[model samples]
Target: MVVKMNLKHVDELSGGRKRFRRRYPKSLVPVLGEAVFQVAMKAREGGALVSEWESLMKTYDRNVAKAERAAGVAGADDRLSPLELWREARRDAAAMLAAFKDDLTEDERRELLGDELERREADPVLYRAVVEPDAPEPKPTLLDAKNMYLQERLEGGTGRNNKNRLDRVCKRIEATLGPLNKLSLVDLTRDQARTLRDAMLSTRKADGTRLAPASVRRELDMIKAMVSLGIKEFGLQREADNPFIDLPISSKGVAPDVDSSKRDPLPKNVLLAMRDRMREKAQVPALGLIWRLLEGTGCRGAEVVGLRREDVVLDGLYPHINVAWHEDRRVKTKASIRSVPLVGDALVAAREALTLSEGEPMLFPKYARENGPDAASAALMKHLRTVTKNPRHVVYSLRHNMKDWLVLAGTSERVENRIMGHTVGGLGDRVYGGNDAKLKVAYEAMEKAIKGMP
Candidate 1:
């Protein structure tokens, strides 16, 4: 018979996977395997194994009696002593165990181990064995389906160094919800998932700083993904709900992101001041160009940093730069991989960068490491802080201010979205079409907006 799990709604859920075990007398099952014998001894040491032991003994004796009657052993071996009959049963138990040991596979062992841990937590005999004075520490679990998902992603070439992030997420999951580390997929109930969500919201960094709503939200997302692995790879329980799915992460009380630099529009005056400052400084070869490109083209810092000599087509009829993804580098989105007309300070900066890095494939080689985009953002952030001399004004504010610059110039939202290399907002948005007339209009609007700078 399959034993129901110890989960909150185990009684209600059908077809539980746990085993229904019956204990037997040690002599009748003389060799259940050395490991099993040791565990039983440890359980008995604390006086907790007696009931299970007696129950198994009775079951074994009853089964042997039925077998003897079926073969007419009572009449054929009537003179055989009771002690001799038990010895014969012991011989049969040893043969069965030896056959089981010969055929067990690694996959079966791991599943059994995870299941055993769940039983030990509540079983009096096993719980006593667990708390024995010199018992060995329980082993860490790394065989779960959630961990298997991580392994597949890490091995697959789809994401770059995503395993490290996922590994940290796994550790955080274990720390936030202690039982999750040891639980099987079916054992993870909806109620436990709800508890984990609250735990993550209240969690703080090691330095005692509470997580931002976005960070907490990401943690919840990761937890959901982990649980989904079990549902997708194996299967979810039909009776009990999977809390990771359809659970709302309520952001009712959390304030909007107060940091002005984060997706906040920069005032036009401060935007111009930062632009003028970058232009004034000529010591660094392409620093000014990077900043000016962000302001004029509305392109991300990484997109500018990853530009190749071929990408910067100053001699072309349109005089625009291509922002396509190369093998060594990546653009944020497919829309972000389009040509942006070089206008105003951006045109001057591009000409200067071409003069400096004439033969080099990459325009900005310093930031074009494997993860160039992230590095470029960091580089620009420091420059913005230094040039503005204000904690509030950031390099990213330049991109934010560009949207207003385009709209205020009466540039259609459609054209502005294309020029800015942003995702289309409406249902009938334009596809990738960089005709000369549209590029010229975008160039004129950008030039007009940034003209009266310095």
Candidate 2:
């Protein structure tokens, strides 16, 4: 007589063989790649079969647990809403019926579908899910909008800074509004926008100070741009106006020129002192050249740090540095793409830097990668601190110092704007001159500025 041992998911087969079989959860089938798992068992004795079954059960449990964790991490549940799952199941069922109908006779197709229909009938939710139609596509959330915005905007190879800014804004918004993925764009309201702005305003920095108004303004602007892009791109219609647009942010108690007010131009004595320190042989040659370039050309710290070997024109009629955008680095603005004539100490520094570069693509290879300008600024700031203890006297003070010298030397506003890469407002200012004419005026003004420098 055969003794039948009832075991969960273990079936007794022909010739005393046993097979371990289990079905994955419907939700996990896509992740696990199959509906059922089956493995043959070689053990024949009742005790041996039981032991093998226990081991197989443990292994299967582990696999299922791993798959569940993976599914959760992939946000499968979030993407596979009941409606989505229904749509997918309907498509799969139709495809299966069509395929089998082509290969099998009418009786076979009917038999297979009969089994499926019985299973569906057993679970009313499954039956409804499979039969339900015309479910709208999932509404896009803030996270979705942010992702799409980054994809489209960052495709052009610029916008790294913008991307970082947008990420920071999203993080702050989510902190107040909960998970961005859960906050649908259509549901966003002006009250929520005001709440976020107030929260940001109240937010304190690590240094125990409230967030700067300018920084708050920028974050708000970033959110506005993101929402505007999302509405336009997705063609989302809303009953209410975009909450982020025209949001009033009080600039009370904030200076109009907060950034400019924070930094003061280096005094003539301080400038001479820093120059003397950089002249020391023990000083870093590349840093010294970068400093000279900033002082002499009045170019922004990034433009000076991001210069390539080819950008430094040593043999030109007017030896100058081209501050144009390259694949490796970006210019600050359209006006920033002009050439800066090398005059006085800048000429000497560029020549030395060119030789030191040794034909490398970047003039300052140490500071030409991502965030290279920031690195260069930090290093220069550290060096500057050693010369002066004033909080207002920074590496960027050199630009202000050069501006002062240009003004004192009686350079025209156009010449000053050209050399400093400031935006020339009118069409006349922008369209008047060609490269050589601009360079000639810029070189003369820069020469006067350096001569007048104490």
Candidate 3:
């Protein structure tokens, strides 16, 4: 397998300091520092394939620049730096090498360099490091490379939870493979990656049960990503497909499928007790309001927590809350990015929460002040579970109940999904939008359902 160089001066790219990353069949894109002379700015690699020998010019020129500067080989011409002379010499060397040998073996190439080696050998520093070609370029460790990739990755583009997941997989894989910072790029291999998957499969949470299928699958996928990146960054050449590419996600013979039945709907009696109990409490009025919104809208807790005062549309024909994505918080899916009509206790809660949080940006200032959604869920769930005194009946059960409520109310499946921020299975749902009429109907139904309390 032949490794190719796709050299570019760092500045030629749009952003100033995004590390240049290339993948597969070994293309060399430069991660070299800022300089007065940027080579690939003009002579781009993708333009034409001149000759294989040209690949060495960047290395050769860099070596020449180092050697010339050390020996102070300033020419009579002041226009050129020592680096400039190195550049010209590398171009000439590339042409001669192209003419002399089309596909020379290592021995042939070394023989061609015999005289040049002798000339440069006069200076031990230049000859051993360059002209003679045994020394490999400095390689970054697995941790260093992963750090560079993730730092650039997480700072702007990736979702926060995803960024955290990537970090977690690397750490867990490292635990399985041994210390990552000390490990060579070669340590990241198919066998080592298999070890990670095995470890994940055997992994357990506090109760000592084996990891869920979904958890193992996520870890395996992330491991694959890390191993593939390491291979590309290190420029490893192999005959087989990437080790991480096709690992089977196993269920270990049993159905390790996720129990989607976890968030069961609240029974009508239990919900009424919770609503009536929470609503009048002064200890956490915000909690009651938020619970009602979740009940009313069938939206996730995170969506409710991340809601800003500006997003609540009370004046609109159908008062609703926006479940949109924000920089700080992301919804579960694209379908989670719709408005849910605020009805019943939800409308009352939204208005009161708005009044309490008038000066603040977020509707729920406490949860958001700490960090949106997840923190809010934890706080509310603990208290909610204590009061409800039922193991399965928790805060998310409100959302589940909303679905059942809508079905019972005779609302169309389309409007039910729209209100719940779910994908309306049919394409026509999009052709005819989520109109005010549907929202009004859903709101009326939700209002009736929650008012069953007193």
Candidate 4:
């Protein structure tokens, strides 16, 4: 006889003991490893194993009943208790035969184990279809790709330095601009530019003086550059619709005009007076020499500051200082990189300043504990301001004053532009003819004018 058991689900498998759909007493067979305890559970959960377990349970029950009946009647082997009889029945040939037949039953067993194996093999393709069922997936963003592209052209060395400076300018614009500025900058229109021009003109400096029109104009130029970059490089706007294209900018009233000799260039009397004062009042003769160099050479504040001793090529046919590669020097253009012949007071000053340095940097080495080279330039300008009684007319006036002399002596605009590292015809011109020798000749003409000055 066989006991019947119901089907069981697989999820019930857990911690040491095994449960089964079939009910049975503990097995008389001695258990082996931990897995033996789950034999009842697995046998019940599996349909073929359930039937085998039930048959084994029934055989044990029958054998126990036969042993109890035999013991009560004082039959043969009365010493064998019911419990002993049950244990003995586990090894009985009759019970073993029933279990073997159940194990081989064709009706109860299914090839589910093989089915599971088949499913596992196909899972990867099936799972991919379920998770992403349509078109091809997109690649990662191009931000890192863009950075990698720019890394070579715009991210390191000299190119990187310019890129970083441009970033700084952007930061400064964001900080300095106000809400009304948004109206002007947002659309980049001519009306907006004119409105901004009016707005900036209405504003005042820290001291409450009305800001100069020229100051407003320079700032507008910076805004124009920012807008141009937005349209050209960043693709923020369409080129045809770019507002900076034909804006009406008032070139009227900007300050610190390097071209305005009347406002910027130290008057002849002022220049002479400052030179005399510098010779007498400066701590060293070398400081007096630097003053004369600025007065004579018209070198930019940065170029003069960055001048190292080795840039002085004193042995050439036409001896001139190479302003191109001064350590901190940023020539406004390639034309500005050309050599300007040293002559007259400027030559004498350059020679005198060179004598003071024993192959180091400028005639005046930077002071220790300074953050930058700006301090020395500031000092030179301050001293000149004190002597000239024109605090506004700083050391850069040297360049202004020289340019004024150039213009006053009938130097052409192209020559002045070359001397100043400026280019004509706009963006295309700068890109195509980066270094024109014709412009270099014009710069040389400025040097000649300075030499011929009284």
Q: Write the residue-wise lDDT of candidate 1 on 1-454 in tens digits.
A: 2111121111222332222244433443433321121112222111122223333444445554434443445442332222233344345433433444545664454345436645644322232232332334332122244454654433321223355566666666677655333555555667877777777777788879666667766766766766666556554446224567776667788776554425566666667666667667534657777777777777877778778777988885567899887643456677787778887668888888888776666777654444555655666676566645655566666666777777777878777888888786765555444467667876777777665333
Per-prediction CA RMSD (Å):
20.3, 16.2, 14.4, 32.2
lDDT of each: 0.57, 0.75, 0.60, 0.50
Error of 3 at 10 (Å): 34
Residue 226 in candidate 4 has what lDDT?
51
lDDT per residue as tens, model 3, 219-266: 677655655665665565452235677877667576646444455677
Clashes of each: 3, 0, 1, 3
Off by over 4 Å in 4: 1-198, 207-209, 212-214, 227-258, 284-286, 325-327, 361-364, 367-373, 404-454
Ranking by lDDT: 2, 3, 1, 4
Q: Rank the candidates by TM-score, best first.
A: 2, 3, 1, 4
The true-versus-predicted C-alpha distance at residue 201 of model 4, in Å, is 3.7
Candidate 2 TM-score over all chains jointly: 0.71
- Lowest summed-lDDT stretch of 10 residues in model 4? 138-147
Clashes by residue pair, model 3: 6-28
List the lowest-lDDT window of 10 residues for candidate 3.
20-29
Candidate 2 lDDT over residue span 1-454, tens digit each: 2334456788778888889999878888897898988999987543356557656875676566556645555553343333334444556555656676267865566466657867655333333433443446457677667866765654333224676778788889878987777777888999999999999999998889888878898889878878878777778855324798888889798667466787999987888788888788326679888998899888898898878788999786788999988765668889999899998888998989989887577788777544567777888888788889999999988888888999999998888888888998799889887889888888888888888787
